[model samples]
Target chain A: GAGVSQSPRYKVAKRGQDVALRCDPISGHVSLFWYQQALGQGPEFLTYFQNEAQLDKSGLPSDRFFAERPEGSVSTLKIQRTQQEDSAVYLCASSISGALGGELFFGEGSRLTVL
Target chain B: AQSVAQPEDQVNVAEGNPLTVKCTYSVSGNPYLFWYVQYPNRGLQFLLKYITGDNLVKGSYGFEAEFNKSQTSFHLKKPSALVSDSALYFCAVRGLQTGANNLFFGTGTRLTVIP
Candidate 1:
């Protein structure tokens, strides 16, 4: 089976520009999550989706960050007016369900560099 | 608040020697702990997790983690280190009682297995 995949492995954007990163979760996965990882730091939660519903977005750092999983399979994280501080890898993960014990499968992530 | 800490920035070990990566966590209720590994230019891969029951949990690639409630630690360990095992390791934790299923991750420990 194909693992979770992210597009545009690397993206360089100018400050104030908008960028969108895409993620394709594993087939049939019902739960999807997005995270942000800064250089030399751990990943921080961004948002979550159970099917088409955006369950949680509290982890999103700012209003500039927006995420959508409308169809429940593919997801996109869009950053508006990107800042140098937004430079980091955006990771996407999916799981079978939101059960207490389900494991998450992660993607390689899209590294975004804002200058 | 749920949080995780990987005390060490890096851990170096000789091949065939025992290796340990320290991880500590804090949460309001019972903690669901997990370990993940990331190689350079790659996505994170699930290593193992501790939900409940047994204190010792075995994971992929001959890795194991010990859950200590008293210490609030879930350190990853392996009897013999392999050169290929070198990578960035992250420890994550989530409160079982928290309605939102989000993981709090540590800064990550870079493990270097010298051959």
Candidate 2:
């Protein structure tokens, strides 16, 4: 792909249902990040991955939120027992630089709505 | 902690007029400032960043941001506004905050360019 790609552009999940969103980052990107953007709000950091290592996840709202990048190129964010407040656009971004100060390439994002 | 603030919820400007979106930041150490634009239904695109430079940084789409250390502000400015430039603008910052190494974004400002 020419840029970061995310799947399931829209998803409606009943309360308590589990949902998974996927992201495919640009080739050779060293860092991948997950963010949650509620309606009318800026994106908030969820987690960060450097290769297969999960370095920072202090932003996850709760234990129900989980993310993984097994192979480092593709990543998945799984939400268990989704709640109404979980509804937001899940954004995935990648950067060639691992530092937080560098520019990042972002995907279109997957919108998740929990009823 | 590190955080950014965008006080304006909406900004209106006439087409071809100069526009400015204000942003202020609070961080632990030095600040890594960035500006991003998000069009409807699309992911955020990076505009520019101020790492360690001449305080003025140029980015894509003829956008520039001035980093002011005294005021702790980084404002995005454009000499001429365009209809296509009407979008949500976000300011983000990263700092040496303990156990926090991700960019913290502001609420965002909606820019509307009247034709």
lDDT of 1 by residue, A13-108 (tens): 999999999999999999999999999999988999999999999889999999999898999999999999999999999999987677789999
Worst 10 residues of 2 chain B by lDDT: B94-103
Candidate 2 lDDT over B13-115, as tens digits, reads 9999999999999988888899999999999999999989799999999999999999999999999999999999999988867333487899999999999
- TM-scores for chain A, candidates in order? 0.98, 0.97
Residue B38's lDDT within candidate 2 is 97
Off by over 4 Å in 1: none
Kindly provide the TM-score of model 2 when superposed on the true structure, using C-alpha atoms: 0.97
Each model's fnat? 0.68, 0.68
What's the lDDT for residue A67 in model 2? 95
lDDT of candidates 1 onward, in order: 0.93, 0.93
Candidate 1: residue B18 lDDT (0-100): 99
- Which pairs in model 2 have colliding backbones? none
> Where does candidate 2 stray beyond 4 Å?
B98-100
Q: Please, what are the lDDT tens digits per residue for candidate 2 over residues A1-115?
A: 9999999999999999999999999999989999999999999999999998899998899999999999878999999999999999999999997775778899999999889
lDDT of 1 by residue, B7-71 (tens): 99999999999999999998988888899999998999999999999999999999999999999
DockQ of each: 0.74, 0.68
